[model samples]
Target: MKLSINQLRALEAVVRTGSFSAAAKELGISQPSVSNHLLALEKHYCAQLIHRNGRLAEPTELCSEVLSRIRSVLAMTREVEQILEGRKQLQTGTIRLGYSTYQFALPVISKFMEQYPDVNIEARAMASHDLMPLLQDGNFDVAFISAKSPPPEVNAFEMRIEQMVAVVGKEHPLAQFEMLQWKQLADLPLIQREKSSETRRVFEANAIKAGISLKTVLALGSWGSIVTSVQSGMGVGIAMAGEVTELDNLVAIPIDDNELTVSHFLICLPEMQHIASIQAIFDIASQ
Candidate 1:
């Protein structure tokens, strides 16, 4: 009831070796100390933990039960030691992060890695709605997403508040307009992200609210494709704030409707934040 873990190990060793002298030899302790631990455990529990028959010691039923628990405790101790060793491994190690292509998640990630070469990084492309669960399930250490809340299971950093904006090639006739109306964009071919993506979701909401319907939307596989299609004068694309807006060939006009704004989330499971590399990545992503 009130015994040390070492005392429990000593008791188990004596039972396993079936002799105080043998257990002491196995444990590299004096036979007397082994006897003392058995005595101390027996005294604390007020029960016979081990018994002698002929020259051999046998574990009692109580010792069997107690040793079962002690084995688990010792295994847990080993796990703790291994975890500490892994923390050292993370000092200059990789942190796997996930992100979607809608936001400028790449530029921020590339910049962070450039500034910290020792911090290796692995980035996976994923949808924002799915990134949270993968992070919480330990598939990724962290991920950037477009969400206001990261659910109860994940901790989130509100990285950037982005507005879904209509973008077009700089030379396109509509690109020069400072403001756009729903009717103006309705007839233009919309180069959109896959239906599951957040950018597409926001655009859908905006379209529904504005009572603007498009008979034909080019549903591209990736955000980049949408941008490419827009840049090549094939269609107009809507996206969150991206560095693509800085390109001389592209122009981004913010959508002034409630359906257009989405907050960017940098989400992580609570455990991964303890790793030095992950913490550093978090700090860098914020900047």
Candidate 2:
């Protein structure tokens, strides 16, 4: 008969416990069953694998080689079991997703939720920097982060490759213009997101080049809030172009003669790819 898993385990038990009776007892089988398994292994290998003198059984030269081979097979089996266990953990698991802004995350989360009905994903909004600790502590499965401060611990993949836009109140004189410069924006009241956001980071950097600071008439918590406030004659909110879907009530003016790109990333542990559910989500998003 061909060698089998039971045969391998029986061999391992025999080698570890040093006797057929002990191995059989450990495996909850009879001593005769253990001897039968060892004989089957020896027959499969076409080599004598045991030595017996009355009540004692010892490993022969070929038996030592057989033990080594059995150990290798057992090691591979254990690795496969561990891999399968990991996949099971992923299929019915929890994902703690940390996000910087809802403007980027809401749609991604909506799509992911629909795709992975089994994987329960929880989302928490925090500053990009604040989310790092949760990811480091293993509290988070992944993070949608940007203006990413490179940490040696987390793995990041750019997901949403997007560009920034300049919004203007419909009545604002700037709405009449096709393109404008940073100096031109300084003359108008600019609505800014909270200081920690990637959008503001680029805005401030650009303002510095123009020898101007972001002259904010308002600082808001969310991009939608800023957009709505801007529509009500508050001020122009700087945001991504794709986010302005309902602009019938407002105007999204592209930055004048300049382009600003903001890309959001999907971050996770490097080994998360081995997880089937996580890999499934990643694959769907990638497509």
Candidate 3:
């Protein structure tokens, strides 16, 4: 008997989402249909591929071993479909894009949209660390991530190099400095992004190496919130140089550390890079 694509997709979605109903929603199918597909797959192989524990669905050892290959298969299937679609001159399609920051991606997206107006984009904003995993899970066709090094599995195009800077209210004393050291921030109450933020991760790691202990008085979820808190004098905030706008009350001072730099990259699974729409994004980004 031939293995069914729907069955494989059902298993993959269930394991990725961790629940039958969630997988059903992701696949845009009914819950019973998802269950039936998984049941059919398991019966055909004579193996229990998933272990249902309460609401969570955990893949069995056998399933775990095959999941990566299944993902590759699915990715390749999409690639083939895109290849066939490309013969149509890339008139219409959707690009699932995940971005950590809009500062860089917005411009490229703007250019791509101007050229391919018929193409629809589904953009999701997430933290840098969170974006990569979702991109790898095939949730996003492409992503903009901030990191010191690109992951080995994807093809990355350098978008921009950004430096970490200290943002302060104009009344703050640190605002007068053109450049500040890690130790200069040690005594200040800091406003930062969540723990999962790559900016925070980079800043904290550099501070530790500089032997400085810093205090974070607030952990905000978004750059806008951090900027607002800093402008209101809640605390000093860390941000990328580009993230700081020309707001009257806020000042962005350079951090005098070489390692305080982050490279923003536009990345996609290597297999999907040749797709016409995906290739167009890369081209736009390079310019």
Candidate 4:
């Protein structure tokens, strides 16, 4: 059976937009044209691809499988465009990256920028959970995540490992110590990153394992806010050693327990990993 790219794109738009009309609007065609495309695809495959429920078309199992392949095709199509652009000029193109906890990936991006001055770079810093959906939507080409394991859909390369440290205000008594035990945190009110952050998850998991429950005084969404709160003497905060900066009023002390090193992973959709810009960034990271 033969299928056209238009048919696959129409099906993908229908599923992604949840209706033929929306797909038509996205494709700049009429609804009937979108329907015809799907009809032709179903005829070629000899299987129903969608089940209409009022205004929405839900994918059948066959369509579900086809959608996955279509995404791969679309991604490859984008990669082909990138390849063509690169052939025109190897020194120019854009690399869109998403990252959680900026400090872990900053040095590599800096070096990458220095090496490829003409390449355009866009970076977004967000919670690990928030970045994945953006990555799936193709808003980002790659993401740097702090997690023990990346989701199964992506190819993940371990970039760095950092042990969690206790950050306290310089005025706080704990500031004098070069190292502190996890159990010592039992008495300090904690300033933690929001629940969606991987740093918070890793710290909380190890905190439980060590039989310590944090007395959280504030839960801030951004790392900067958490650090500011710590500086204000609101409470102690947990952070990776590399993540803490602007230390004029704060200090990071190593935790005596060694089980809390958060692994930083560079993640991208497996299909897009071979793109030149990503490979260049990955090479810099591997160094």
Which candidate has the top score in lDDT? 3
lDDT for each residue of candidate 2 in 108-224, tens digit (9 for 90 to 100): 777877866656778888767677766654456677776624456556667776667788777988788776676777756778777777777876776677687566888776666
TM-score of each: 0.63, 0.63, 0.86, 0.85
- State the lDDT at 62 in candidate 2: 73
Model 3 segments beyond 4 Å from truth? 25-32, 75-89, 247-249
Backbone clashes in model 2, listed as residue pairs: 179-256, 180-256
In the order shown, the candidates' Cα RMSDs to the true structure are 13.4, 15.2, 2.7, 2.9
Enumerate clash totals for all models, in the order shown.
0, 2, 0, 0
Could you give candidate 3's per-residue lDDT for residues 1-287 as a string of tens digits? 67988888999999999999999999999999999999988888899999999999999999988886787677667656755786564565688999888878899999999998878899998898898888877789899998888888899998889999998888898878999977788878999888888889999999999999989999887777887788788889888898877753589999889889988999998867867778989999999
**Candidate 4: regions farther than 4 A off:** 21-31, 89-94, 110-122, 133-139, 246-249
Ranking by lDDT: 3, 4, 1, 2
Which candidate gets the maximum TM-score versus the true structure? 3
Worst 10 residues of 4 by lDDT: 82-91
Model 1 earns a TM-score of 0.63
Estimate the lDDT of model 2.
0.70
lDDT of 1 by residue, 182-214 (tens): 788777788876666676776787688889886
What TM-score would you give candidate 2 relative to the actual structure? 0.63
Better of 1 and 3 by lDDT: 3
